[model samples]
Target: MKHTIFYILFLATLSICNAQSELVKIEADTTNIRIGEQFEIKISVGETENVIIPKLSKLNGLEVIDSLKTDTLKNTISKKYILTGFDSGAFYVPKQQIFIKNQVYETDSLLINVATVKIDTTKVKKFPIKGIKGEPYQFDDYKNIVLIALLLISIVLTTLYFALKRSKDDQVKTFVPKLAPYQEALRNLKLLDAKLLWQNNKIKPYYSELTTIVRNYIERELHVPALEQTTNQIIESLFDFSDAKVIETERDTIKKLKRLFEQADLVKFAKAKPLAEDITSDRKIAEYIINNMQPILEEENSEVSYSTPVVIVQKPVIEKPNTLAKVVLILVTAAVILILSIGLGKVISMSKTSKNQMENVQ
Candidate 1:
């Protein structure tokens, strides 16, 4: 029994020694390198659980350029240190400690040799240092500044052109009649009749003008946006007015107006041509509708006078010029000009200085 116990203790000690030997290891990529050359030192641990790598403080004749993070693969954890040396000598990378699951382990030390670069004086010729030389200026040197200045000028000119054109276009003249709305509408009807558009193969224009006059009258007198509304919408607005006791009119009159608008739409869009008698009857119906609505207008606006003369004159509408925009544009233009001038002066001065430098060297 005493012999067996001694043999078991010896086997256990051997296994512990083997585990300590295999746990941590250190290696170098190369033992010899030239001065100012970089190399790597790798530390590998056998165990992967809760391993901590000690910080490397300093190394003699070498610098720790970088330290890579620990990498885990299956059962091993590994890290790498990038080292570079500037001195021509041999250096030893000292041992590093590792902590794994509350147990301490150590890595083996490494050696690296740094060699100086050699030159042979017999094969190489020596020359004296020369003075600085000046090169001639080329267009490519200042091309960017010149191109930028031209682009800015072009943009400013384009903006100014559009602004002036818009200002000119804003000077438009509109004609507004001095006569009352009802009187003006009646006069327009008379003018339309005098034109005899349908008789001269202008049926579309005749119907368009006829409907426009009536719609304008309704809009002005009834305070409804009849001109912007569709035919059905106009009729519905009229019905609403009637329901509110705003205006009293026969349903037949509303239906007649609807029919007239529909016929005009068919003539204009669908290219339907009515008989001359039908056209004349439509004209009479337009007149009847206008006369029918005049009494309602007088009742609503009794204080309005219809004695004003029927004179149409041009009323000019001039938009105020954008003063702030013009100011900003002027400032921008001035700034660009100033920058270009400064850049040009600098280029000319540099060219002169460079020319003098070459002359002096010669």
Candidate 2:
């Protein structure tokens, strides 16, 4: 019985020594500071095994500026943190728990005092305000020079206009017609296919160009600003527009386009690798959408009987006048008026001066 009791005591002492071998300590640089002043907290761990650091991104009343790395020695590791507080008050840095080898160890909480700068009312003083200064104005300061410059510019422009008018017949007339939106989109898709962008591993640029062509077509054909809209935003705007009009039939096409844009976004942003089948599917969808959305050509309207089953009535299209020509005409007329006004004003001033001289001589 005596031998057994001594053996038990020896085991208890050994266990206590083993537990005390490892130590964890936390130390701070200071305990008090003015508000927004920074201080350091050093955490030291002895006999470090597998250890997990606590997340210290934000404290209740304190802000973490930087967390320094653990300095490793033979059997110990030390970590340093810089923290600050913006409010003036007493605050507690919460206890940090560390996990190691299925066991938990925690640091004791720390208390810190933050104070604001003190101000004294006895040291304040008052001063009188200064008077404002004024600048004298001149009536004809640089006005004559500016008017003369305007007159000269108008004369030069008038001379150039007549010269260009006379030489207009010698210029070649290049009448390049604008391509319809559908034609432009189809041509671009053909060019894209020839390049085989996806096969060449240029997926992002390929999708970007593809989406741009589709957006431009939407803007030109439907007057939608698809280029500047996100996928979700474009869908929402289209749905709103459709509710007001009879455009429910185009919902399927919009959904297909949305899927294509999302897939492209994944490839461009999320680094997704698409299958060959997927690329072919997208191409087919694009082609189908463009073909279906092409502008319909109408033949001349003929008189039809009232008993006809289906009589498709086409609305007459009105063409707008050339806006550029109107703008140029307005600018030319304004310039001519300005020149004539200046000339008349100068003549009236000269006549007044001569009349005054004649009166003085008499």
Task: Give the winner by TM-score.
Answer: 1
Query: Model 1, poorest ten-residue lDDT window?
Result: 166-175
Candidate 1: global Cα-lDDT? 0.84
**Per-residue lDDT over 88-158 for candidate 2, one digit per residue giving the tens place of the 0 to 100 score:** 99888877776666677667678989999888878979677644433233446446756876776687678
Please count the clashing residue pairs in each candidate, in the order shown.
Answer: 0, 0
lDDT of predicted model 2:
0.74
- TM-score, every prediction: 0.42, 0.35
Position 98, candidate 2: lDDT? 65
TM-score of 1: 0.42
**Position 354, candidate 2: lDDT:** 64
Where does model 2 exceed 4 Å of error? 1-22, 124-160, 163-362
Error of 1 at 39 (Å): 13
